[model samples]
Target: MASRDDALRALEDRDWSGAEVDTSPSRPAMVVQSIRLPEDLARWVEDEAARQGTNPSVVIRGLVERAARPAGRTDVVTVRRTELELALHQAVERAIEPAA
Candidate 1:
C-alpha cells in the first residue's frame, strides 16, 4: 500500500509535519497469536466465513467476542468491514432477513 498509495506513503514516511498526536488508545492493542484447530473445526470456520462473505479471521473474531460476553447480555454485535461496508451489511442481512 505504501508503495502504490501516496497518502499511505506519506503516513508511512512518519514526517508528522506538526500534526497533533493522540497517544491514548480507545481499545485494547492488537495481539497476534497462532493456534492449531482440528480439521473438522477448521472446515466449519471456513464455511462460516464463506457464508458471511468475510474472511476466516473475522468469523473467528466474532465467535470469540460472543463467547467472551457475559450470559444474559442483550447487546447486539455487528461485524462489518470499512471497505465494501454496504456489501458486508447486505450479505449479513440476507442470512437472517427472511426469519427476522
Candidate 2:
C-alpha cells in the first residue's frame, strides 16, 4: 500500500466496530474502506472515472473486482436456484409443447 495521509492512517489503525467480514456472495454487504493514495494516482483515478462517465467509486470497484477475478473465469454471478428452476421449466414446456 502507498503511504497514506496521517488522518487516513489513523482511521485504518482504529479497530473496526462493524461486521468484520461478509462471506455471502449474493447480496454481499457494502463496507466503507479508507486508504491513502498518492496525489497523482488519485487524480488519474478521478480522470479515468470522468472519461468513463462514472463516479470514482465505480471505477475503483471495477479495478478491484477485475483484479480479484482473473481472466478466463465465467462464474461471476448467477440467478438463485428457484429462479433457474422456474425458467428451465418454462423453456422445457415450450420446447416440448405439441402442435395440432
Candidate 3:
C-alpha cells in the first residue's frame, strides 16, 4: 500500500503540470474515521438521498460539511420558508410535466 504522502504527491503531480507549486503553509490531513451504520439507518440514508435525487455519499458529505462550518460564518445564508415552498412547488410541477 502506498504511503499517505506518496498518494498526495501523486495527486498533486496529476493536478499540476509543471506549474509553480504554492509553498504556503497548509494544515495536515485530519483523519476521519468511518463507521458501519445499522442496516435500518443505512437504508434510511439511501432512501433519503434517492428522494432528494442525490447519492448517499453526497448526502453524508453535505451533512459533515454543514456540521464542520465555523460559527458566525457570513458566507452561509439561510433560505426563507416562502422560498423553500416555491422551490418545492416548482420541483413537483417539473416532475409531473411530460418530457418534450
Candidate 4:
C-alpha cells in the first residue's frame, strides 16, 4: 500500500491522455411533488403543454416559477392585459408575418 505522500506523487506524475473535464452548468436539485387541480384547470395545463410541445409538468413548473417571483408595484403595470390575450395577440401576429 502506498503512503499518502507517495499516492500524491504518483497522481502528479500520471499521464493525462484523454481526460475530459465536464464544463456543463450544474442544475439545482429537484424533488418530485404532487398536487390536485380542478378538472378544467388541469385540461388547460395539458392543452398549454401540447401547444408549447412540452409535457404538463413543464407547464406547471413554469407557472409555479412565475408565481414564486416577488410581486412588483400594482399601480402601473407595463402590460395591462391578461396573459391569454397577450398570447393570442402574439400568435395572430406570428401567423400574419410574411415568410423571409
lDDT of 4 at 39: 100
Give the alpha-carbon lDDT of every model: 0.80, 0.80, 0.80, 0.81
Query: How do all the candidates rank in terms of TM-score, highest first?
Result: 1, 4, 2, 3
Local error of candidate 1 at 77, Å?
5.6
- How well does each candidate superpose onto the true structure, as a TM-score? 0.55, 0.46, 0.42, 0.48
Candidate 4 lDDT over 26-100, as tens digits, reads: 766789889999999999999998776568998999888778877873453343367657667768877998987
Lowest summed-lDDT stretch of 10 residues in model 1? Answer: 75-84
Q: Among these predicted structures, which one has the highest lDDT? A: 4
Error of 3 at 99 (Å): 22
Assess candidate 1 and give its TM-score to the true structure. 0.55
Alpha carbon RMSD to native, model 3? 9.5
Clash pairs, model 3 backbone: none
User: What TM value does model 4 have?
Assistant: 0.48
Error of 1 at 21 (Å): 2.6
Query: Stretches of candidate 2 above 4 Å error?
Result: 1-27, 76-100
Q: Give stretches of model 3 more than 4 Å off.
A: 1-34, 76-90, 93-100
Report residue 10 deviation for candidate 2 (angstroms). 42
